[model samples]
Target chain A: MACETDKALLQENIEEYIKDDNKVVTCKWLSLMHSIDINVAKRALHIFVHHQRNKGGNDDINVTFFVAGLGKSKDGDLMHKCAVVPETELEVVKRSLATVTSCHIFSVQKAKLKDYTPLYMTDYEVIKDNIDKCNRFSSIKCPWVSLKSGLSASKSAQQDVVKVVLSENKGHAFSNKTETGNDSPGSKTRALAKKVEPKGSITSMFASASKKDGGGNESSKPVQKTDAASKIKATKKKGGVTAFFEKKGDSPLKQKDVLLGKDSKKMDASSERFESNVTNEKKQDPKRKKKQAADADEEAPDKKRRRRIKTDLFDSSDDEDVEAGEPEEPEEEIEEMEQFEVLDKGIEEEHKMTEEEQKEEVDDSSLTKSAVVGKKRKRTKKVVSKHYEDEEGFMVTKKETVWESETDEEDEASVNKQEKKSHQSNTSEDMGKLATKNTKAKADPKGKAAAKKNSSPQKSKQTSLMSFFKKK
Target chain B: MFEARLVQGSLWKKLLDSIKDLLNEAIFDCSSTGITLQAMDSSHVSLVSISMNSDGFDTYRCDRNLSMGIHLPSLSKIMKCAGNDDIITMKATDDADTVSLVFESPNNEKVSDYEMKLIDLDTEHLGIPETEYSCVVKMPSAEFQRICRDLSQLGDSVVIACTKEGVKFSASGELGTGNIKLCQSASTDKEEESVVVDMNEAVCLTFALRYLNFFAKATPLSTQVQLSMSKDVPLVVEYKISELGFLRFYLAPKIEDNDGDN
Candidate 1:
């Protein structure tokens, strides 16, 4: 059985392969068996489609199982039966799952993810009328059939119209208006940064700090640092959202439906923090800083953004805040969660932040209450970066200032992993449903859907295309 | 996309000859560029540097700037399968850490992705001397292999003395003295070649023939055999492999230390 997490990755990869007219895509199906490069598969598919269009007459030739396994035929090509002595159980399972998932994405079925099955071809027009408008046949072959179905037959171009929209918006970072240069899709960055813990040197420093005192230590530092951090964020998050909402209208959020939470308890929580978290992104790290006026401009934005996020925590503090007087203790928990979420997202976005933004996390940690007021320090000043070492004892130094030039597609695996995690969270009904469809293709081979019939000779091309690899 | 399921029962094999010189005992210290790998018969030598494109399985989808730090576990897998004729596909998803390989064995029985690891191959020893040779020669690996095989029968110690023209390999026994001569000529007339001597300097150093035989077993074929020595200085024999570079060994001649034959 494939694990839930891996299944999710398999599903996404499969879906992305078949989602569009992916008739021309290249996908690498990774299972326990040997890897099949899809680019080669596509060329094979092109040849198969070419073969189907070439032989206009349908004689029901029995060929290999691709779409053929489940007693169905694909975009009409030659057919082959399953190999008599099948591959190992694991290979059989993976191949079977791939076929089923591929069929579900290509053929028409119910709009809902659960109702999808590989049984029916989506377009009845092609099936009932026996006419594929988009496909073109240059010739026909079959001894029993009429020789009259000649050269240059064509079919209509029906672009795949059913789009696969993720059920949940898969939340993007909010109030992250600094455009911190620290940018990558949330899902991928999380997997990698999560895997690469900030433990190398800084962790040892933490251990040494605990040990250096001969066992009786200054355990009070982390708590104080946390408190100070919370205080600073409380003061900054306010204007951040106001700026984004007051102007941009966040039209992108509409399509994502991040507001999809069903419960009033959750909605109220989302809405309040949502207002601050969502709307206040407008007040950023001085989007339009004065050219050279150092002290004043530097102080304004940091204080404002932190103040906004911090205030959003207190003002909303979960549904309990609705009572006007929530207990102070529980209130603090909600505040920390919101702050952590906000900060985590900030770190996520700050992926591209110049050396300047990196210094903020480092410097802010070192600040005493009086420092922010007394110094008109330029944010870019190296002195601020130095301050962070004094405070965090150098955890921030271990992290890259920002990833500069990498593209976005590289994170697909990590994003797929994140999708699985969200499914694990079972965040919502729709999100779960959407996630389930993707996960099914990758998870266990046992519950695999039966393969449909389509003579996808694309596989032979895959083997052939892969031939050049050893030499290359 | 098309997919195939392969069962396990596949075989992959490859036979690569060292067209260049190689001293197998020196496989560890060969420089990346100095025939660290060469054809088994002194045909070609290659300087190789294997580097990871990214930290894990990541590779540039196209030619672009990518910086990835590979781990060790993955590299060993690649090295293990270098001789396999299986299909190997290393595809990098967007994540730098994500890399996958599909290894399809020649028998088509199974294909699996073995992970790749990044390692730093540093074999340059700072203080080692780039030894200057006083005497050198070119001989097949088999000839030396055979000579070592035959010389061990006489006694353990085989003395190698060289002049400008050729080398004289002699081993002494209580019953008699055995001497083999290799001259510079192709030996058109003589059934056995003689050791041509001009005597710019005549130096003899004795070494255990058993050690020489063991060294040959460890090496691939050799088209050239080079021996560099000074009276009692260590002798250096190196074999250059085509693409793999050279393998070398340095052995100090045996001396009759204080407790002779005790």
Candidate 2:
């Protein structure tokens, strides 16, 4: 049964929805169902009930009761059914209300008589049982039920894990039910085991699902959930609530996860699965390697790519000639590449890390801000990419290097975090140098890459190998 | 001091009525020889020159050269006090700030005086070089005014063409094109109805119809109007002030883009 506040919210939402198009609200149920937009459906539902009562010539009937009658549809023998709402009508209203609220309607609730789980239940019971007051629901101080999260952790987790599976099967809708059924048991157990780490892993899973959906070419099997979770964990640190449900889902468990113990375990399993999947993915499709490399190039700090390209250009000039398809001008290209390399080494330091590891490292560096609360914020665990530090200045310099160009969008938040850390006896000079390096890298890509790669261990290895061959 | 008295005040009234629409104020230079007013319309695309000799006035006197700036609308309003046959006397002391117009009825039944405020106007006086026009047309003033009024409905500008055979006033707009051609009249006894074009070469020029209609307001002042045209020069529409000189209107021809011709 709907609470007084829920009824008021419904009335206000319907009013706002119908205020624009009063004609559409008067539309018949059959035609109303055909409306693709939910606002139209909600408004049409209001008008349907309005007209229904008007047909009975009940001008004297309370508008509140008439509005409450919105949950009752006149279908077949169900006409004039006692004002107690039907489940199907609630489902219809919820569908339309989802559009009105700019969110999905997961569940509708009345004020419960007792205390429940503290995880995901938003307080919707503050409407103060006065339907006839015509009070605006907007003015009423009811904490909104976030549609992204479940009513309770256990209940919403099962639903969202199923949603995660369902979203995974969206591309292949024919096998959706079977795939969802298969994962229902495993995800249920994983959901319980991942209670503390739900936001991080679930959000990461959503990000990977969205990434999968973006790729569209890949036929996703249910087995890829662990891999998806890992990739999401990698990408979702900077991308908060990228997945639809994850935004609301993040709100729950946000307050309750004091224990970091279970979250670290979940991250390890997901990261291991991610690393395994990367190898298999690299092997199955050589084309995908180039794409992943490009994706890495896109995701990698501009400073790092500049460094990598710089090293790739200089140490192995012959290798680049073969790679870039400019055999006719090899001498000139190598000369140009050398000149570019000399200028680049004056600025950026090169480092060698796989693109995936670099992305993980970037995410981890961003997470360094929240590292104090490791257990509670599962999002902080995404900082998995830690480079081997030979010196404090050299290794820690990567965060400033990562601050270069492409990551500037996400870097703003990360910059705030870095600023707080930099205020306490950290190298402020390196921060300024890195800031200038970012601007320079933005100006001259060729110079930035060559300069950036100067610090790469990979470049040193390649150069040493070349010298060995030359000595031979 | 400057004083000029004319027998028929209605003539100045008609001239003022026609030019008042184009010019707000004008400097009337009163010399020992005559009174000459030279001014451009507000847009500077058209110029009006009124030259009246001292011989045309019943009495004329100028103590020294005086250029009096007069608002045309106010002059038109003062002229309204005079009957068609009233004697009009315009008087101003040396460096007078205001000009006085005295009107006396023909039968001495009524007399009225009007004093109008004068303003200092900085006006550029263009020396119009005299040129032998390629075409000169003499047509009935009312007929010319009628043609301008009718054709202005067709477009913003009227293209006047003078050939050996005839003179044509043509206009084209969104509604359609209209052309009124009056061939050289062969000895029409009624001279006012005749079209006489003396042409050395064929001449065609486009002048804004709005100004042409505004120039047509002088229809009440004269029986005939003379139009003179030459290539790349301003077209002149002159109404001769009988026993005086002339009230001539000079309009710059429209520069038609060659792109349209090509």
DockQ values of all predictions: 0.01, 0.01
RMSD of each: 31.1, 31.3
Error of 1 at B211 (Å): 2.9
DockQ of 2: 0.01
TM-score of chain B of 1: 0.52
Q: What global local distance difference test value does model 2 have? A: 0.53
Judged by DockQ cut-offs, the docking class of candidate 1 is incorrect
Q: Tell me the tens digit of each residue's lDDT in model 2 across A167-273.
A: 54553453344346554444434333344233333233333444434311111222244333323322322233333333332332232223334543343343333
- Candidate 2's C-alpha runs over 4 A off are A1-472
Estimated TM-score for each candidate: 0.24, 0.37
Give the Cα lDDT of each candidate: 0.34, 0.53
lDDT of 1 by residue, A1-472 (tens): 4555554454444334344324212211211011333333333434433454476885222212223233222323222222221112324634543243222112211122232122222222222222211111212123442211111000000000001011111212321332235434543343333332333322222323332222212222222222222222222222435433322322322211233323223323332342334333333234212211333333333313433443443433332223222122452244233323333333222223223432333223222211322432221101111011222233221111211111112111222221211112223554444334333322222222212001111111101111111221
Compared with the true structure, the alpha-carbon lDDT of candidate 1 equals: 0.34
lDDT of 2 at A308: 60
